[model samples]
Target: MYRYDEFDQQFVSARVEQFSDQVRRRLSGELSEDQFKPLRLMNGVYLQLHAYMLRIAVPYGTLNTRQLRKLAHLARTYDRGYGHFTTRQNLQFNWPSLEQIPDMLRELAEVQMHCIQTSGNCIRNVTADHFAGAAADEIVDPRPYAEILRQWSSLHPEFSFLPRKFKIAVSGAAHDRAAVRIHDIGLQVVKNDEGQIGFTVFVGGGLGRTPFIAWTLRDYLPEADLLTYCEAILRVYNLYGRRDNKYKARIKILMHEAGLDTVRAQVEEEFERIRGGVLTLPEGDVARIRAYFAPPAFESLPAVSLVETQTAARDPGFAAWVATNTHAHKVPGYVSVTISLKPVGGIPGDASAEQMEAVADLADAHAFGEVRVSHQQNLILPHVKRDDLPAVYRGLVAAGLATANAGLVTDIICCPGLDYCSLANARSIPVSQRISERLGDPARQAEIGPLLIKMSGCINACGHHHVGHIGILGVDRKGEEFYQITLGGSADEVSAIGDITGRGFSSAEVVDAIDTIVNTYIAHRASPDETFLAAYRRLGMQPFKEALYGNA
Candidate 1:
C-alpha cells in the first residue's frame, strides 16, 4: 500500500525515459543483443525461447486493486491475454515483443510500479510473507523493512553489478512463509528478553545447482541496525564471492568455501565500522515507512461470522473452498483467502486478464482494496471479512478462479519451463499439468493433506523444486524429457533440501510415478493426520523408493 512520492515518481519516469532510448537504439541497430543484454536485464526484460519476457516487481507481494488492474491492462494490451505469477512474487509476461517493452514499462510506471531490481546481478526485489500484516501469528509487519531494503538496494551505486544476483526475504511470522532460509539473506522478526523487536539474520542461503539453508549470521540484530548489518553482509559477499565461475558466484558458494564463523567474523568487523553511519535507520524513517502499511480500519465484530456459516451449510462446495483456501487472520471475523491459481489441470500461475480484473474487483469489494501475491504462485485476499467470503467465492467461480486446493496435492508450484525459458533443458508445465490431472480429484487431494509439489525446468530452481515436499526437476535425457524426483524437502522454519530419488522417469511415466509415491504415502502413513512431509520424514525414503522402483 506504499504510495509513490514525487521523488519516486521522478525517479521511475527518468528510468523509463532512459530505457526507452536504449530500446530505440537497439531497434536501430546501434546496440546488438550482446551489447543490450545487460541493459534489458536491468529493466527485467529477458530474451527467452520465443520472445521477450517482462517481469514486473510486486514489492513484498503487496498490491492495491488499482495496481492489479494495471497488471491486467498490461496482460491484455501488450502481451498475451494471460500473465504468470512467479515464485519470487513477480509477474512475467512471456510473449511481449522487444519493441513494446518500453511502452509496457511506461504503463507500469503510471501505476507506481516498475521492473527495476526484479532481475540482474544487483539485489533483486525483497520478498516478505504475503500475509505480513494480516496473519494471526506475525510478530510485526515485515513490509516496512522490506520497503526500506528495496529503497536502499535499488540502483545502489555500490551494488549495481555484483559477482552474482542476490535475493533477500524477511518473515514476520514464526512459520516462515517467506521461505527466508533459502534466500541470500533472510531476516526473521523476533523479540528479546525485554520484548524489544529485532531480527534474527540468516545469510548465504540459496537454490540453484547447489542449495543451502542460510547460516545464522546474527541471532538478534537491533531494529535500528538492520540496514547497517545488511550492508556488512553484502559487503562480504560482494568482496569475496567468486567471479571466475558464474555457477560459483552466489553467496552460498562463498559461504561453502569460507566457513560460517569466518564469514560471521568478517561481517561483524564490517558492521563495527558502519554501525553508526548514515545507513543506520532512524526510528522516524521506519515509522514513516510503516505508516504506509498500517493495518486497515477494521470494524469490531464477533469471533465468527454467522453468514459464512449459513452459506457454507447451504453449499458444500463453498465449505470445501473455505476449508482449503482460507487462513486464520489477526483480526477477528477476517480470514486471508488464497485464490488458487493452480486450478486442477491448468498452468500453475497463469491468470487471464479478465481473471486478474475480476480478482481486483473482488479484492476491492472484500479485502479493503488490498491484495497479495504468494511465493507459491497464488493470489491472496489478505484482509477478507468472513461475511464477504461467500460473495467473493461467487465472483471467483464466475471468473474460473475458484479452485478448492490451496495447500492440497493439486496446488503445484511450477516454472515456465522449456516452453518459454531458453535455459530450460525440458518442458516443466506440461509435466506439472499431467501430475495435477492425475491427482485433481478434490476428495483425493483433501485426503492427501498439505502436500507441496514443486517443479523446475532445470537446476536454476525457479519453481523451487529443491524445497518441495515432493520435488520434480525436469531434465533432458539423450533426446527426451525426464523428471528426477525428490522427497521430504520443506521451505519452512525447519528447512531442508530434498534428496533425489534413484533415477529419472520419462515424461509419460512421471505422473504414474507420482501416483505410486502418493499411494505409498497413503498406505504407509500412520494416519491421515500425518501430512505428506511428516510421513516422508518419519519413514525416510525407503518405502517411497520401494514404491517408485520394485524391490528385486
Candidate 2:
C-alpha cells in the first residue's frame, strides 16, 4: 500500500479542520441547509432520507491493517455497529450524526484516509483491479497509475467542478475484473509488439438513466503520456459536456449527443496542445510510485499446497469455500481470497465493527497485513499463503464472513435503496435478501455456476445493475414497489448492458421471477459447465422471456 507522506498528512489535517469549521457553522445556524449542501457534499457527506451518510474513499481499494482497524473503530464509535462497503470499493456509514462527522473525518485522516471527491461532480475515487499486483495474468499493477491520478486530480482547479461526476477505472489483467468498460474513462494496460507497456484507452462509458460501453479512444497510449492523455479527455468533457440538465451532464451523454468521431477529434486536438507539458509523467516519478507497490517477500514453496488439499479433504465446508472464493495468484503456493460480504439472506455489503476487526486480524495473520475492497462489495486478501488456508477459513467462519458464495447468485451486488437514499424509488436490499434466500443452497449455487445479480433502487444505477448477468431495477408503480429485470448484462472484458424482460413485476413476484430465470437457464444450458452468462448469450433472451411472460 502507498503510505501517506508528510505533505499528505498536513493536507488532510488542514482539510479536517476546514470541514470541522464548516460543520460547526451549519450547526450554529451561521450556514443554512441550502448553503451547507455543496460544502457537505465536497467533504463526502450526504443528507440521506433518514440520516447523514459519510463515504470514505479507499483509493484503488487498498487498505492496510491499521486503516482497517481505524474503520472498525469509526463504525463502532461514530455510527451504527456496521458499515456498508460500496460498489466503488469505498465504505459508507449510513447513520452517522451530522455533528460527529468531523470527528470521523479526523479519525480517517489519522489513518491516511479521507472522503474528499467521494461525492460531487468531480473525478471521484480512481479505482483499479482489486487483485492488481497479485493477479496471475496482470501486465502490470494498475494501482501505481491510480495513485498518480489521485495525486494529480485531488483538488485540481481545472477539473474540480466538471459538468457531472466522473469515474475512472484501470485494469491490468487480460481478464477485466475492474469493469473498466463502464467507467467515464477506462484504461486497460496493454503491451505493444515491442514489449513496451501502455494503455488501451476507452472513454464515455457509464451507467445511469443512460448507459454506454466506453468507445475506444486510443489503441495504444504510451505509458509516459498517461496523465497527459487523461487530462486531455477531462478538458474535452469539461468544455463541451452538457451543463444545462443534470440528466444529460455526464460525459457519456456528451458522447451520445456529440458523436464519438467529433469527441475523438476534440480530444486529439487537446492532447496535441498538452501532450509534452507538465502533466507528462516522468520515468523517475513512475519508478518511484511503482516502488511503493512492489511485491511482498514470498518464500519458495511447492506450486500446490498439500496442506490445503489435506485440510479440504477433511472439511467439505473448507473445500467448497476454496472452490468458490479463491483466485489464482501470480506467485506459486499463494492465492487471493475473496471474503464474501453477501451471506445468505443478509444485507449484501454490511460488515459489523467486530467483523471488520476480525478481518483486520486475519489480514495481519494470514495476508501481509493488507486488505482490498472489491467493487463486488467483497473484501479481498490479495496474497494469502495456500498453506494457511484452513486458519484463514476458520477466522472468516468465526466472523461470519465465510460464505463461499463468490460470483454466485447469493453473492449479490445491491445498493441501499429506499432504506438510505432519498433518491431511491423502492427498496433494493429487501429484494436482494429475498433472492439470496431463495437461492441460498450451496449445491444449487454450484449447479448454477458463476452468476452476478446486481440490483439498484433507482436509475442512478448505484448497484451496477446494468452489468449484472441478471439485473434488477426497483421502480415505484402507483405507490407500490415494482421490480424490472434485465438479462445477459455483463461487466467483464466483453461488457454489455442487459436487455429488459418485458413488463415489470411486483415486489412479491420479483424473487420468483429470478428463480424462474435461473431454472430456465439450468434447463436450457448445454451442460453444467456452461455459465449463466454464456448460456444467456448463446440462447438469447427469448427463452427466458417466454419462460417469464409465456409468449406475450
Best by lDDT: 2
lDDT (0-100) at residue 518 of candidate 1?
A: 95
Task: Estimate the Cα RMSD of every predicted model relative to the unseen true structure.
Answer: 0.7, 0.6
Tens-place lDDT per residue, model 1, 109-157, is 9999999988899999899999999999999999999999999998999
Model 1 steric clash pairs? none
Whole-model alpha-carbon lDDT for candidate 1: 0.94
User: Measured by TM-score, how close is model 1 to the native structure?
Assistant: 0.99
Q: Count the backbone clashes (under 3 Å) in each candidate.
A: 0, 0
lDDT of 2 by residue, 293-313 (tens): 999998887889999999999
